[model samples]
Target: MVETVVILGAGWAGLPLAHKLLKYTLPEAKDGLKVVLVSPNSHFYWNVAAVRGVIPDAIPDEQLFLPIEPAFAQYSSENFEFVLGKAEHLDPEKNTIELVKNDGTQRSLSYDQLVIATGSHIRSNLPFKPIGTHEETLAALHSLQKQIDVARSIVVAGGGPTGVETAGELAAAYGGEKDITLIVAGDHVLQASHILPSVSQVVEKDLQKLGVKLIRNTQVKEAQTDNAKRENDVAVAQTRTLILSNGSTLTTDLYLPLFGVQVNTGFVPPSLLDSAGNLALDKTMRVTGTKNIWGIGDVGNLEAKQLTVTDAQIIHLSSALPTVLTGDGGQVVKEYKPSSRKMIFISMGKKYATGQIGEWRLWGWITAYVKGRLLFVDTAEGYVGGKHLRHASM
Candidate 1:
């Protein structure tokens, strides 16, 4: 009897891991193992380029979101399978996972091993979240752009990279046509403490030069989570209101919140989650207290959820899985070593960016090229075929 390897989520870690699983492994170790990918979405969005996506008509929809079917067509007939839906429930004790189909039916698949990499979500009006299809996303993005075009006053809450980038982009794109204000809860943008002091200062200087008003030590008192409602209000509201924790009221044409990232582990039980709803994983990327289930990417409680770090995790798992899963005893298992240094590529716009490589902060067109230019949309296109499972364009 062949064992099954079910992987949940088709993000950075899951897709690459699927490719590796198909490339290596000789089909069987006494009984063999098959791989199945479960996801509710049909397109693998180049979500990193969302800043550019929010910009009206900046890039084409095909560049931003690539259908996964083209990528998976590269693979020949094999033991791999893709379920068109999301995991509704996971039962480790029974070794079975249930997936809810698009038509609202539930399908259960049993597996000998499982990997979870559902990723996280961010709350922002910059068209950052993943939608159903490429065209739908593009249409919504155009709406956001229209709102940006006519807005007289813009109040952007949160000092994270998205907020900073949006503020800068709006100023640069509009050329001081709109009054752009950035409000951060921390001492400086990017949480200040998270990046080098000099790097943070440089970012602020860039925003100031772009005519963006920086308001530090402030948070949004009125929490809004509905993206559709946000869009509707942006089109309808002649003047949007933002109530701040500092007791200051902002009247603006647009209120964009670049705030918290919500982890996508709601399908999972709390027993497998941390305090923040993130999947709890051991040092080896194995889910806590589970011998066969692994967690990776933003969904896991890893120090860094960057794509590079997730790739490293996949690399380690590639070498470790065969020995651990094939019933081979006494195999040396390598523990995942997460990078101690912090690395980030934050775009001020397509022209400028700020980055951190270890102790050094890289700031120039190089940063812009690395992450800002094309927003890596072209790079993401190279990885379309890894996830071949698509029932719908969405």
Candidate 2:
């Protein structure tokens, strides 16, 4: 009997897990074992560079998008399968999942073990995540770049990393040429619970130096387009009127809101989710009260959604899954413990950066060399090739 492992979402979590299993676990496991990866997009999106990707000629399209199918061509069909579709529903009781394909067709799949890594999306329509199919994401990116080219003024809402990075990129590209403003709802930016005030202060100074106007303690209440008229069936580029929380109105040529993140858990059952609609997982990354189903990446509520956290979870789960597949009752797999030390890296355009690990603040040049220079796009292909997994195992 062939036992199947069905993994959902091929972003940071599912893609690496699938590769690791085929490369390491399947060869050692019982003869009958296979891995199936399902995702809405056929391409893996390198969204870490999305902040700079929006800027004209900042990063090429090839660096940001890579086909998911070709990455798995080395594995034989008998051991691996890649399904292009979105998960429509999950029936944990039956160990089955329902998926809706791109052509509006539905398919059902059953698995002995399941992994949920569906991740999350930005609140607004942005290229920060895999917004839809590969073509759709590319379209969004191109459209945003075109807007940025022509826009004289840009307003970015939300004080998070994306917002800060976007503002910084615009400032760097068009500092004295265009108007760039960043609106932070709180008194400081990078307001994640673990970030220190000093870190935020440093980031603020960097942004200010880059010529970004900081609007502190203010939020965008509403945004209304000044014109709805279409030019030759396409909506014309029009000014946006933003109503601020402080009872002021500001108009800009472009408005970008990078605020909240909504996890893609609609297919999951309510009982398995936390209050924020994220999968409730134990330290082992297993869904609470479930044996065969596991959760990772932004979809899991175990820790904050950071690339470093996601990478750690992927590495831990990959090592643990082989033991989990054996169904040995007495053997215990190591539990996943998230790091308590605060770690963050913010790239402020091409020239400057700021971040901290634990209590130590990284120098600007260190951050630039490590993250800001290429935004990790150089390693994008390695991720698809499972180089990270091979390196980790050694």
> Largest TM-score belongs to which candidate?
2
lDDT at 55 for candidate 2? 87
Q: Write the per-residue lDDT of candidate 1 for residues 43-87, one digit (tens) a residue.
A: 777777776667677777778777765566656545778676878
Cα lDDT of candidate 2 equals 0.88
| TM-score per candidate | 0.89, 0.96
Count steric clashes of candidate 1.
3
Q: What tens-digit string does per-residue lDDT give for candidate 2 at 27-51?
A: 8777567999999898999998899
Which runs of model 1 end up more than 4 angstroms from their true locations?
26-30, 123-126, 131-142, 192-194, 223-238, 327-332, 386-394
TM-score of 2: 0.96
lDDT of each: 0.73, 0.88
Worst 10 residues of 2 by lDDT: 228-237
